[model samples]
Target: MKRYLFIMSLIALLGACAKKEGKFDRADGTAAITVASLENHLKILASDAFMGRMPFTEGEQKTIAYLQEQFKNLGLESGNGSSYLQEVPMVEITTTAAPVMEVKSAKKKFTLEGLKDYVIWTQRTDPTTEVKDTELVFAGFGIVAPEYNWNDYEGLDVKDKVVVVLVNDPGFGAEDVSLFKGNTMTYYGRWTYKFEEAARQGARGILIIHDDVPAGYGFWVVQNSWNASKLYLDTRGKDLYFSAFTGWVSQPAAKKLFEEAGIDWASTVSAARKPGFKAVPMKLSITTSLVVKAKYDKSHNVIGKITGAKQPDEYIIYSTHWDHLGIGKPDEKGDTIYNGALDNASGTAGMLELIKAFKNMENKPNRTVVFLAVTAEEQGLYGSEYYAQNPVYPREKTVANINMDGINPYGRMKDIVVVGIGQSDLEDYLDAEAKAVGRYTSPEPNPVAGYYFRSDHFNFAKVGIPALYTNTGIDHHEKGADYGKQLQDEYVSKYYHKPSDEYDTSRWNLEGAAEDLQLLFNVGKKLAFETSWPQWKKGSEFKSTREQYMPKVN
Candidate 1:
């Protein structure tokens, strides 16, 4: 009897050990995120049949349907209360015809070729809009930020006149540490901010001078994006305030115009960087006309949610833009479709895979996790901007947003780049998770690019939500930073925003993307269960907005 009892006790101990190992196995959940599955999804989504997944067309219908079907299969509830689609009303305007802009001065009359020397478009809805003899004023940066105590429009009455402005802020252009966060771009540096400020100043026209460094991308990106039809959110049929004509002038053209006014172009740019700099009238008048075609339609934002076990009203949002530049002017290779494989198709697929992972979790979250695939990101983040304004989940209840825009397809990395680092407590959470996997986080190498303000998360961040946007780092585990940077440079120069952005299985190693997805999944999982709210960092511009919406309580 003693021998039998001892044998039974030994078997019991072995069984207990087995149970513990199984319970703690990380693969149990991570297995749900497979590189093969992600590849398959990308193959279908990025295929030419989807017509580049542009919103408000046959392509949009197919894309949204696929998202809805997948979300339904995962048993996720519709985020829009019984509907997976959120209608985003938009206005599409195509410039049917625009002639070369003619600038007249007493010294000489100059004619600049449209689409070559300058690209211009209007925000007004009128079928025919013309600017005749509009006096051009050279505004420093077209910035008026009260917080920074900077106002470029200080001593200038730009009413009914045209304003020529620099692309980025004075601080960014000069790299001066004392100016507006130094090399890091503030909201005042964004082109959108410049346009809005121009309108507020009652300027009839606005032109931005393009330089590669300050603008982050080459002139080709601006030329291509601005040459096509533009889309904007249609807000309740209200007349939106926009300049008569908004445009970008090639660097050469801007220099020629400044020289025509007997001003040293280089010296003027230098002076613009100084405080108390006054606007310089170019003493030239521009005349331009446009014939436009306008159409109004509704695009859709695909939304799905998993309700929590406890605080269902509170929400953690995962967002990615699903739209790309549709069929447009052909590239050199004659490929017209912008497949957008890396730009956002990777992000969209990652979102779906993440949804699957969360659904397969051992236990449901304690607060709701909402998956949002927005539209019109390529057209100035319209879909997200609309959703931020009319949120399916109340802004006050919305806890945080983890946005994935571009996922690295290359191999694993030793570090990750936080696009907008030092903005919120979310960075601490990300660092903790990254450290667990023997990795670390770094600030974006090119802060002057204003990439933080460029992605879809900016809309959520604008409303005080702690939004996180990180990218794969340049420091590759095996190849090092040089190889990683080479790949990134190649993508930007050869494929970014072009039809060549299709996926190449041979080149893509999705291990890094899977790791990123896992990190994001863990972050959202923690936020879903915790009662603590992540606050924006002390000096962050968004801190006051957070305080207003979610006031700290003792």
Candidate 2:
């Protein structure tokens, strides 16, 4: 009887040990993801069937449907007031193509061919708007940045005149690295800011010169993007301001215009760098007209939330833009759909995988996890901006926002590139999580492009929430950092903003992407349990805003 009892006791002890080991093992905790999962998700998201996930089209419908289905499968709750769809009111303005832009000058009249030398668009809601013989004015960089102590529009009334400006800031060409982050494009250097400032100055039109390096991408990118069907959030209800016309001039076209005005283009650019430079009257006038059809449409932001077991009110948000450049003018091979496989399909899929990982966790997070797949990121971060302005949850209660824009297809690496590295304490969390996985965190390789302010996270950051956006590092397992950088450069030159950016399982290494996602998950997981609120880094533009906006705990 004693021997029989001993055998039963030993069997029970061994069974308990096996169960404990199975629970602790990473493989047991979650199923190992197959490359097939990533490929399958990308195939559908970037498929020609989805029409490139454009915001205001049937494609938007199909894309949102697929996302909703996925969220349902994951058992996540609807994030938008008992529904998964968040209504985003938008207006679609399609401008009839203009044939030619005539610039009349004192010495000669030059006609700029549309699409060949320049591309122009209008922000006005009117059916027809004309800029008839508007006077031309050189408005320096067309920037009015107080932070940099630079105001290009100072002491100048550019009203009712066409403002011609440099592509980047004054400190760009200067030898001093300390001057305006030399060579790096500041927020003032962004074309969006330039156009907005022009409108605020009451200019009739704004024209920006295009350069490859300072602008990050080549002139062809700008041409292609502007030529595509443009989408903008409906500001009809709001008192938004814009000039009569907004456009870009090719380098050659700009040179001819300046030469016709008897102004040396190179010398004027140099002179603008000096202190207290006045606007140069070009003695020229620009004439153009736009015919528009305004249609009100609605876009949806896909949101799903996993409620916290304890602190359900406090939240951590994970976001990625789901929209891309939709069907447009055919490419060389007659491919109209901009697949955007790498531009964002990869990031979208990563967010889905993150949802899976979070759901698999044994202990539910203390803070609710909100998975937000926003729309119209390509259209100047409009979806995120709308969400920030009208949040389902209070912005103060939201602990942090982690954004994924473009995920690296090339496998695992030794480091991660934090877009806004020094702006918040979020980097410290990411650094520690990365170190645990044998990786480190670094700043963006090309900071001058102002990548920090480019992605969806910037919208949350602007509203005083600590936001994080990181990309795959340059270092590669088989090829090292140089080769990884070369790959990135090749993509920028060849595939970026092109229809050729489709998915290929053979070339992609999702191992690196999975690792990055795991690290991101860890960061959120740690924060979800912490009792202390994460603060923005000192001296950051957002720090003071947080102090003013967020409720004090003391």
Candidate 3:
């Protein structure tokens, strides 16, 4: 009997030592993040049969059902108690704007063609959204950040007026790195923020002057979105405020507005960038109307989780938006459904790969791992916003958020791009894992583009969570950086937000995506086992928000 007891104790010791989570496997598929696994998932998710995976349609029904089935098959517990679906109340608004938007200055008058010179949309459920000769105020960047000592609407009463704002923040082209995030764009710079601030300041309407370089994408992206039906979180009971019209104007149209006001375009641009710049009324008014048709519905955010072996209450999250632009205006090839293959299908696939990687491990994590596939990212991140506002897990106990937006379809990269690099300590975890595999971390080249605040991860970041969002590196291992840049540029110009964004096996090689996923999996793997919590960096905008919930010991 004593001999038997000793043998059992010896066997238990060996098993415990063998289950070390610090192996830090360097090989790509060693952690189950293989190229084959990614391709197989992407093929089905990006297939036309999914009908572009739009919310409130058959596509959403099929997509969510598939994810739920996959979750059950993978042996993951339903993240929401006893169910994977978290119902999101939504309202779809389709706005039809008048073709010609008449602009009248005190001295002169002009008319700009809609869908070309400008595009307008409304979020209100009201049948008619009309702005009749609303005064235009050029609120420089339309920011009201007390930290930067900047408030463009300070001396100006823009109530019931249309505020025309620049697309980016002040530090976009500034020589000084001290100015608001320097060249890196902040939350203040986002067009969504501009509209929000305008509404907060009692403005009835607002128009953003769209410049291609600062706006990231071309005017066609705006035209594509506003011209189509839009989805917003249903806030019927709450007193929600939206401008009469949230719109964008072409550069030429904005220049014409300034010229008509006798406000020198060059001088206004110069003054806008300065620290003490104030709001200027263009002495012009915009006249346009929108016929709005809104309908209420429910969308589901499919969620799954692997409970922790030790600290079950503490959680780490992996997120992706499982949605794209659905059937819309046909392209030249007569394709109406926007596949969104590279935009998000790849990302959703990658998130699944991470979950599989975690599930395959013999040694379960110390903290819980939550896998969230959200809805309606293309319609302005409503799904994630819903989750952030109504999380299944407590925000204080949730450790970090690792988000995948789009994975690299090109082959292996020499480095990985870290968007919003200095925001959190989560990047440090990623850097360590990336270095283990002999690759390097690179900061995003276009910091002023504001890629950080554009995606679902931004929703998590907004509420004090330290979120990590990385992209495929530009420096290709075999092909040069120029070649990588060319491929990316082509996709942005040709396929981004278009029906042509289908999964092309001919153009895509998931080797790079596999490596990137392996790295991300390793980061989450480390976080899951360790007790250390990743925090927002000292100077990060989210740092204070985080500190409110998680105070530092020191």
Quote the lDDT for 190 in model 3: 88
| TM-score, structure 3 vs. true | 0.88
Worst 10 residues of 3 by lDDT: 20-29
Best by TM-score: 3
Give RMSD (Å) of candidate 3 vs. truth: 3.5
Clashes of 1: 0
Off by more than 4 A, model 1? 1-31, 96-113, 155-157, 217-221, 225-227, 255-267, 281-284, 328-337, 552-554
Write model 2 residue lDDT over 314-350, tens digit each, in one string: 9999999999988877889998889899879888887
Per-residue lDDT value at 520 in model 3: 87
Candidate 3 lDDT by residue in tens digits, 368-393: 99999999898889999999989999
Backbone clash tally for model 3?
0
Candidate 2 wrong stretches, greater than 4 Å: 1-40, 47-51, 97-117, 217-220, 225-228, 256-264, 281-283, 309-311, 326-338, 493-500, 531-554
Candidate 3 residues lying further than 4 Å off, grouped into runs, are: 1-30, 98-117, 132-134, 155-157, 216-226, 251-265, 282-288, 328-337, 480-482
True-structure RMSD for candidate 1: 6.1
Candidate number that wins on TM-score, 2 or 3: 3
User: Which one wins by TM-score: 1 or 3?
Assistant: 3
Best by lDDT: 3
Task: Tell how far residue 12 is off in model 3, in angstroms.
Answer: 6.7
